[model samples]
Target: MDVTGKVAVVTGAGRGIGHGIAMKLAQNGAHVVVADIVEENAREIAREVESTGKTSMACFLDVTDRQSVESMGESVINQFGQIDILVNNAGVIGAAGWEKRETASEADWDITFLVNVKGIGTVTDTISPHMKERRYGKIVNIASVAARKGTATSTPYGASKAGVINFTQSTALELAPFNINVNAVCPGLLWTDMWERIAVRFRSKDDYPDELTPREVFDRFVKARTPLGREQTPEDIGNATVFLASDAAENITGQALNICGGYMMN
Candidate 1:
């Protein structure tokens, strides 16, 4: 597939890693559909894409909503004439204490599955028909290292991401016949608003020990954990996604590439 002339849909493109991926794709000459639950951020992202001289459309999308996912898919097809790439990047961090197992509620579990796992399933399924018609597609699901091991206290998040990995493999097998490559990118610690929030949640508000802000602390944590001695930036994940979406990764399907700065070598 020639990415330069292709149309790509990216969920959660409001900010952070999703925004980074959208920007990279646009920079590489792909028309982008920046979908996000956060309306303002989504618009901002769309504008940013356009600023780079690429076509971009912003849409309010709640991935967990079947209607929303289907609508967005239709919009992409209507606007661009065909769908070439789909990036499932929208997800949520379950309410605090969701990983306590016994304390985790059914509602929390359902939300995690709904947004983190099923959301991707919904979007991909809706777009599959278009890809099948064209006999070409590239899907990059944003998973996390949490799926590979036990998160400190984010079990639901971890489990949902694990589901993402398994689902990616399953989808790849099903889509390969149509020449679509379905894969997942499991990002490790990074400097993003989500990471800052997680850091704040882990630290005591009064005495967090570190003098750094929550975002800084999150970066420090990644540096401490990874052999690379630094956190993986959104740009890092963006580059990986571009490679996966390009013909360079045509032979790479049903795979989960860890962009975790060597944090998880397996």
Candidate 2:
């Protein structure tokens, strides 16, 4: 998985899984562009990557905003000459308290789709042309296990990830002719900010344990539900991503690999 000298762009890389992916790519010798909605976070991650003796640049990106995404792509191409890999990790769980479908509002649904599903399209649409012209590229989309099953508490989020899976297949088929691979990674229980919000929801339930903290609930869930008997880490997701983005996975495309601790095997 030697990605040395390759230029990679990771969205939503300020923190959490995206941050892990960016760091992993850098550690593997790829020049990483840490793009985030928060300029501070992007710069922070870029600095972290630079500290490891790897090249990096921070770019402010609003995935839902077409112009903003396009600008980031153009800037990266202008600076790096080409983008070898794209990791679409930017997404949202929607407005707090609207996780359940019955209580979910149209606004929540719209925002979730805009960021999770449509945002990937926008960024890929902006960068794929460059890859097409160069006849080489790797795209990794961050999906979720919920995408494969219906969730009572996370309907909209699940649907949005489902869209990501389908979009990955579509793009993989279309991009295959150009020698590009498109794939999706469905991660299980990682304690990201997104999961923190879910922890809040769990704490609010009457059945929630009295002595357990929000994180404890996650630990319990992992212990009881995950066959692997542990929660997945951001580094786990990052390793899978680097493999998918490397030449090692050249024959793999239109596939959704689960990094869910065997939580949702299919």
- Give the top-scoring candidate (lDDT): 2
Worst 10 residues of 2 by lDDT: 95-104
Candidate 2: tens digits of C-alpha lDDT, residues 1-266:
77889999999999999999998898888999999999999999999999989999999999999999989998998899999999999989876565333467888899899999999999999999999999999999999998988875467889999999999999999999999999999999899888877776676466567577878877876787699898988899999999999999999999999999888997
Model 2 misplaced regions, further than 4 Å: 96-102
Backbone clash numbers for all candidates listed: 0, 0
lDDT, residue 200, candidate 2: 64
TM-scores across all candidates?
Answer: 0.93, 0.96
Clashing pairs in 2: none
Model 1 regions lying over 4 Å from their true place? 96-103, 205-212
Question: What's the C-alpha lDDT at position 65 in model 2?
Answer: 96
